[model samples]
Target: MAAQFDKIAIWLVAFIPMPVAQGLGDCFHGDDRDFSSAPDEQRFRVRSDIVVSGFLAGDPQETDFHQCGETVKLDCATGEVLARETAGTDGMSFHHFNVGNTFPDPEGGVVDNPNEFCVNFLYDGAATNPLGPPGSPDVDMNVFFTIDPIGRMLSFRGATNAFPDYEAYASVEDGPPVVLFQQKHTLDPINGLPGGADQGVSATVAI
Candidate 1:
């Protein structure tokens, strides 16, 4: 069955508590700050560290998958590619991508205040028992990060599976977390659709 984006958003909002939801908002827009005003030279001096982590969730067989793409960091304002890391092997279910220090400015300076960035997690693999034939679809997971005025970190991950499942999470941290999980699914790229039964459960809880 095909998965609907609207339905997934509504379900995630319902699953998350009001406080957590508000916290996510704060991360994205709470603080009034921008990187445009900083001088070209000074901007390069400001830096924010980033770390990406995630693991497979649910039944081992159902969640069995691998990443065929890379994790990338993009400048929110210009949509420029800042850095990227390659995907891990199939045997390594838990994945982590760390860009220790990122300079958000064009001059390669650090961004000391509130700023926004995006991380993409892409995967192409098969499940042990997918709703359809294995290796047919690709999964694209995204995480958006906002650094508050004081450098507090807030992030959110939301992805729709080629299978009948979705995963999402919101988190706040003083520094980058040691690990994060990549949402999983089975898809058929040729047909451009998911190929599995609807597993009616919110995998966000695992986050």
Candidate 2:
């Protein structure tokens, strides 16, 4: 009976279709930008750099490819927005942004310190609809974030769906240096509805 079950499993595996190959957009990095001259000098200084690359299948003729969600940094205690930036239009599949010194903690107030903060990326399919029909497939959209602290530097990378739900919590002194919280729901090829994986990690860095 066990052998029969194994044979059946092998047969089912043979029928499973492979995931389609998707195109990644033009990649970008924040290192190229000099934020010292930004309007908000105090907050615009570069501290954390993020590089992103991915693709969303959209109407090539229109500017739908130019549309993407916003990324934000917030105070963990007060929930106030510290800084925000949009995924710029590069006419390609890739996007990138830098969270510079612009991510400051509450001043002399009772607000939490800079280390107690969180970063988020909001990706809505509705915003991308202008590029393609509803329920159209969007390939892998991902982000790579790096931070420079007093003693060391750390990095993290995560993959997102067409409609991404991403968040990152600052590390506590006693805990890991970075933690990523993700909730991504993507279109199912069979039903055309949202369904996908939910992954989270608390990453510690020694260097």
Candidate 3:
């Protein structure tokens, strides 16, 4: 019985020392290996945007697009014009259309240059008669606009069926009309409307 007790004591001493050494080593250093010594990882993420390219063609089915005698105003800031253009047609027309006008640089002062601008007359076949017969001739609409060098619409006048025609110019003798505006062109020797008569004497009609 004494020899059996001695063997049991030896076994316990041997087994206990192995687990204690392992526990001390584990507490000093973690179980995970040094993976940071390897090459660094390169991660990436991507995003996309949806873009619409062209004008909104006129739609006769919708009531907003079919409305007659409409006027629209556009406001542009120091930011992008595309966003401003989308906001401009909010209350005016259902169909979005673009006109020929260059955005004035926002940095430029008001008096630096009169921002060049023009407006479009949108007719989607609803505007056929103007208090007259259905067979009336098609006449171009006139647009009066005031602009700043900051690309802002200060004021404007627009009419659908009643006008002085497309080529009508304000006259001092003719008196003022319902809309307050004027049109005048400054002729310059160096610069004039493109494709105008080069000089006079040598000009010939084209075929």
Candidate 4:
């Protein structure tokens, strides 16, 4: 697979109140499981976001690569984003495939709340998609996230592909996404698409 253009920015967002950032939505309102006597719906503000992307050449695919698009998270209080990437990680390769890295993706989440929200993102090893099991197709380290933050965040429980919690900007009255209910099954813990760009690795007009 060859490389695409410099940067391909894509936003898959569905706001309840409406747009964010440039006059972003004030908050999101909705019902809850306890409709019998539920209180008034709380407003959720855009608390944070995770922007996963790759530059033209020299894409980031290593541990603590700031521009790898997995280093920062939005910080609503101080009006800034928090650092999500941790330096000095013990990342290792499994059969040429790297693993053990954390990447936060809030905007990728569809299930939001005024109090609680699940963080969605990938662990990183998937990005260094090395050759798989002898006969597997050729893999690229900097090309495993063509649909990242769009894939699915791995959780212990949950069913259906929910949005990335890292992508959601909706939060409640200066509070985090509220907890509508607690889901115990099929939680989204896995987050990663099949491909991306960047890293120390580069091909001669190839991925």
**On residues 1-207, what C-alpha lDDT tens digit does candidate 1 reach at each position?**
111111010001101111110111121111112222221111110111222322112111111223222334444455555555443333223222222234253234653432222122222222221121345333222233322212323333333434322332233222212223322324323322344323222222211
Runs off by more than 4 Å, candidate 2: 1-133, 137-146, 155-159, 162-198
Q: How close is candidate 1 to the true structure, as a TM-score?
A: 0.25
Q: Give the per-residue lDDT of model 4 (tens digit) for 103-188.
A: 22223423331111112233222111121123211111211122212121212111112211211122222333322222111211
* Rank ordering of all candidates by TM-score, starting from the highest: 1, 2, 4, 3
Question: What residue runs in model 1 are displaced by over 4 Å at the alpha carbon?
Answer: 1-134, 138-140, 144-163, 171-207
Which of 1 and 4 is the better model by TM-score? Answer: 1
Weakest 10 consecutive residues of candidate 3 by summed lDDT: 6-15
- In the range 14-132, model 2's lDDT, one tens digit per residue, is 00011121113211111212212221222211112222212111111101123343334444445455555543333223222333333322222332212311121222221222222
lDDT of 2: 0.27
Q: What total of clashing residue pairs does each candidate reach?
A: 23, 6, 0, 55
Best by lDDT: 2
TM-score of each: 0.25, 0.24, 0.18, 0.19
lDDT score of residue 205 within candidate 4: 13
**What do the candidate models score in CA lDDT, each in turn?**
0.25, 0.27, 0.20, 0.22
